[model samples]
Target: MDHFLGIFVVANCYRNGIGVVRSLQNANYWYQKERDKQLVATRELPYNVDNGLKNMLLENKYRLSWIPYNEFKNIEKIGEGGFATVYYAVWDNKYLDADIPAALKIIHRSKKYSEKDYSEQFIKELKAYCDIGYDNPSFLECYGVTMDDVSKEYIIVMRHALEGCLRKNLSSVAMMGWQNKLTLLLCIISDLKTIHSKKYYSSRFT
Candidate 1:
């Protein structure tokens, strides 16, 4: 069982005297133990200035498992950025269960970039995604990372926006009334507030 769940069970036992004497102190101790476990897990992440990128990726919960580049089928180039190109692909989840209709972000190994320059940008983007994490409607869910054997490029697996970007959706739709616009703006603001409230800062695109 997951350690978090185990910790909850222990706390519950202490609270109701299921197997142990009912004591508020004991219940709180078990809860604190779980909190300490999480802190220890976090501390396990490497954080050296010289190896910042790799160290950040060491937190495997968000770092993800390796998938061969060939596993993704029907890849269609959707967009491009200064450092990476994005694609929509069908992910093969034979090894590990994962979501389908995923977005594949491939890094551009440009001649203009030195090893350090390319890695720094890639790491920055990856760290941002890991910080956002899973199960939030406002942010894209990042599944994992993979490497292209042929191209030798790093790939970031993420959730695909089926309707395309927010800018595209807004332009494609008919003119909206003030009420509709206000509703959309409010929703966006709410999501932003949630992100800001968290200790981890998220750099998100709609």
Candidate 2:
């Protein structure tokens, strides 16, 4: 219980710019603290943890290996969303055997959002991502989340999509013959069926 609440406490600190200078890294660090403590307790428990719970935790546990901000180099702004700006960055993964090209989505420094609002939104979005899980073929792979030490801001790390958005692929779309386009459309429709049946969002091709 302490560790669970500690996650939020650290998050609150980041949201309010209390002692932490509003760092997502600090908040993420505490979130992992709770997860690590829980994992330890689970291993020590006498009874078996339910397979469902175990799988769920397993799916989300990669956050424990949050990448450090300094590891990213040559960040190029790629896109922007309602709440965040996206960048393509080169990441040197200390834990992994090789370097990875990645995408970073940094939350906008909003003037209108209060600390509480930002904190709540952060938790909500993070939870959504965690619930979605990894290993889905249709979605971009997420590396993890981290914060810039100098900026005191959080950024989400994801596998970079070098081909760019579907709109950029429209020229190829126009070049395709009717049969090929039909096959592509049929495939998309099939994927859409799966997505709808699962009630999940995912990226797909036209």
Candidate that scores best on TM-score: 1
Per-residue lDDT of 45 in model 1 = 21
Q: Tell me how far the alpha carbon of residue 61 in candidate 1 is from the true structure, in angstroms, after superposition.
A: 4.2
- Model 2, global lDDT: 0.56
Task: Please provide, for model 2 over 20-101, each residue's C-alpha lDDT reduced to its tens digit, 9 standing for 90 to 100.
Answer: 5654456446544534443311122112323333343345554423556788998888777678788988887654434667
lDDT for residue 119 in candidate 1, whole number 0-100: 73
Badly placed stretches (over 4 Å) of model 1 are: 1-58, 61-63, 95-99, 134-138, 171-183, 194-206
The C-alpha local distance difference test score for the whole of candidate 1 amounts to 0.61
In candidate 2, list every pair of residues with a backbone clash: none
Give me the runs in candidate 2 sitting further than 4 Å from their true place.
Answer: 1-64, 135-137, 176-206
Clashing pairs in 1: none
Residue-level lDDT for 196 in candidate 1? 67
Q: Model 1, range 1-206, lDDT digits (tens) per residue?
A: 26555885786566445666655467657755643443212223222222654455455655354455667888898888767789999886553343257799997788888778877777777766655543232355566666666776677877676565776777643587665565556545654665665555544465
The clash numbers for all candidates, in the given order, read: 0, 0
- Candidate 2, residue 16: Cα displacement in angstroms equals 46
